[model samples]
Target: MRMSMTDLEPSRVEPEERVVILDFGSQYGHLIARRVRELGVYSVVLPHHAPLAEILRHRPRGVILSGGPASVYEPGAPQCDPGLWQAGVPVLGICYGMQLMVHQLGGRVDRADHREYGPATLEVEEPGRLLAGLGPRVDVWMSHGDRVDALPPGFTVLARTAGSPYAAVEGGDGRWLGVQFHPEVAHTPRGREILANFLYRVCGCKGGWSMAEFVERAVPALRRQLAGARALCALSGGVDSAVAAALVHRAIGPRLICVFVDTGLLREGEVEEVRSIFTGLGMDLRVVDARDRFLAALDGLADPEAKRKAVGETFIRVFEEEARRLEAQVGAIPFLVQGTTYPDVIESGGGAAATIKSHHNVGGLPADLEFQLVEPLRDLFKDEVREVGRRLGLPPAIVDRQPFPGPGLAIRMIGPVTAERLQRLRACDRIVREEIRRAGLEDRLWQAFAVLTGTPTVGVMGDRRTYGEAVAVRAVTSDDGMTADWARLPYEVLDRIARRLANEVEGVNRVVYDVTSKPPATIEWE
Candidate 1:
């Protein structure tokens, strides 16, 4: 496939050198691309069994084999086309990818006597191209049952753990590298540095991928794709959808109609923000304040999953109505642009077809919907999306907005959904967001939102005993939503947020910060 014209621009990060991450049914496969992008190089993630010709067409500078839950010894384990290794691109095999590399290269692997599931220390015996500059011992996050027992020809074991002899290995020629642990996740100490070393030293890839280049390239392509057809985009006011809508408008001037739905569960001032952004962008926009419709549909829903399903279904219904209106007004509506990212596809269990979370556009579409979906950001990560936004001249506040759940505050309410509870949570969440922004930690924190726990306890307010709902503040730092760590917020910052929420927001007694990470706890309480 020929590279798109948009692909040939001087990005903040250069696109000349790129990495292709081949997904092998791993949950964290997309994270690999995200890590690489953070290093200033562009990357694309493809399915494990993607054709070698398809991969080579992009002309990637390097390749990464992601760790999957599959066992390489299994008869039907996911395998790449043999031609991939011969592409001459440097290959980095991770976990299951390492096992597959070993087995394919004539090495031996077997079920370990003891599975390594958590943090483990690895001793680097011989550091070379991959492990250069790293100390002799390093802590790594490991999650594997099968272990590499022997090295293949022309390969040397560079590092090892107590249970696995071939924890880390390198091809004698130094082009291929393998590690049994996942360096893409933060729980693995020095994970970012490990990935940085690979992109800079081993692959000789320069970190030149930037969002500006994406916008310069993508806008024109989008115009071409939507030529003479009416494109409708679902605007959620969040950064992803906002950026997506902005890019679409840039692509097809006045041909894109942005539909903003007031789901009734959004944060404070969200609807106004959406309107301001769309109007400011000079987009052909329609604001549908269907707060009552959404709230009625979500009435009596207590389960978080059920709430999501209800909201998603209702959104499709509203979208379909708008699409019908557009068809009657404009005579034709053929495309529905979405803000779906690479992580959404992977978490939906790429290839294996496991549904992690149903995106409103992906799984929430009604059967009777007529528009074909157009997802431009499907191949890009969140950070890349932000870059594209910056390139498109979006304001910094809108471009760097934190990740919000699709169901909005509906899912943040721990107990039954009520207008009062929603309002309270919104107020509390606003305070937290304001404090973080004031502290200049907004960009560093992935998401920082307040959850309303219906369970209330007694507290003293001005010497008078009172009982109210307890709010919990969840602030996490993450590359992709798959794995995350709680942000180690400064004590003063946390204190400021808590004090403001308790004093300003009514009906809240206590405030707490979530210390848990992704493994034990997801970003959202519900």
Candidate 2:
């Protein structure tokens, strides 16, 4: 079970004392790590079966076992290192992680008669260290089919739900704790309290880490890695890339050349806006018009994955062309800098986790990319990246910009990408953002944009029966991009958006709002 260097690569900026989160294949594995980081004690995620040596390598103050979808009894199910229990570090097992811990110990776990899969009330029985501050009855999110039926020796029940008797348990030296429900999700209102208790009370973390410290550490690391080599940064004008560019520029200064490519899939006036923003910062910025190239690559591609790959490959090719052109001016650029964040990496199958979707930058890149990727912000979340941007003195407009997909409007279009469809989506997307901003909810919501469903609907426009494309508007609120809830914009604002789309934007008849959350549906329709 020993890991190679690549498999054990540090995903984020290395913190001196961190909580090591073992990913057991849950979609929320990274979410668990994010929650720990939000507590100001840095965390790193590793595979569930990572060896004990590897776990100790992180100098973990605490180890959190993330919930997974697999049954522990199933053959080939992921298993933890048996030595972990005796390793002396505090361990908190969650969901399947709890089941595994119980099963590994002398405890017995069996399938519950009724599976607890949603919001449930946790009644504190003993109110031990884990549930000490929370009141008797606490709300929690549960998604487990199997429950702990019998406790191992020295283990005591802390809390219980109707469906789960041994919902929360503590055992052995006051360090080992287990919870059947997830404490990382938004559903658990005081989940942060529980995690903070674990970090500060149990693990004794100082909670001293900050994004400013990350910038201080990252600049020195970047300078050391790049030495004097010139780098071409992929500037998407979004928060991640902008922060990454600023950090890299701080490290390498004039040697960092930012290349902003106009994919034509972007919203209206984005190219000019990005150009102005970076040029004003005095970074050597290069703007390339690759609209036709991107459109050609995306032509006839309806599958979301296909379109993402096409766009991704074309972006690398364009960057390569730009690098070649600049090679004569600035000799031999060897590094390609991108704003690839932790969510992008996890979603694109970066670690041992499953791939929900292939982000254009992470999964969509060509196999034969020549330049070495310098993702300064790869270990960061969206919020953390913004903090780093502020620490690096980036403009408010760039740092606070909403999350935009690397594939841009191409993925927003449901069908084949065309010049006409791009224009249509751009207009609709702008109006949705404008209305959201006008409602004074720009900074409140995570992202607000319009999706071209590409489904034709018949409606009366100016008393004429006209069949045009249907557009779906999506607005969401989220802490990190890991989980999101549809934003409930005021009715007045939604009405204005709908009316504007119907009258002002060309060839739009129907407007619909997406109410689905992140688990059932992603923020993006595609």
- List the RMSD of every prediction in angstroms: 5.4, 3.0
lDDT of 2 by residue, 90-203 (tens): 999999888999889889888789888999999999977788799899999999888899988999999999999998999987799999999998888888889888898889
Each prediction's Cα lDDT score?
A: 0.80, 0.88
Highest lDDT: give the candidate number: 2
Q: Please name the candidate that would achieve the greatest TM-score relative to the true structure.
A: 2
Candidate 1 C-alpha lDDT tens digits along 1-526: 1232233321122256778888887665777777787788888777888899988877888889988888888899988877776778888999999898988888988999999999988899998878878899989999999998888999998999887788889994888899999998778878888888888888897676667666766777777777778788888877788888888887787788999888889888888877886798788879887889988988887877677778877886787789887787887776777787766656545554356666555555555555566778877778778888888888987887788877788888886787888788888988998888899998898998888877787889999998987889899998667778899999999999888888988888788888999866767887
Q: How many clashing pairs in candidate 1?
A: 8
Candidate 1: segments with Cα more than 4 A from true spot: 1-19, 38-41, 49-62, 74-90, 112-145, 158-164, 170-176, 181-209, 351-354, 437-444, 456-468, 490-507
lDDT of 2: 0.88
lDDT of 1 at 505: 83
- List pairs with backbone clashes in candidate 2: none
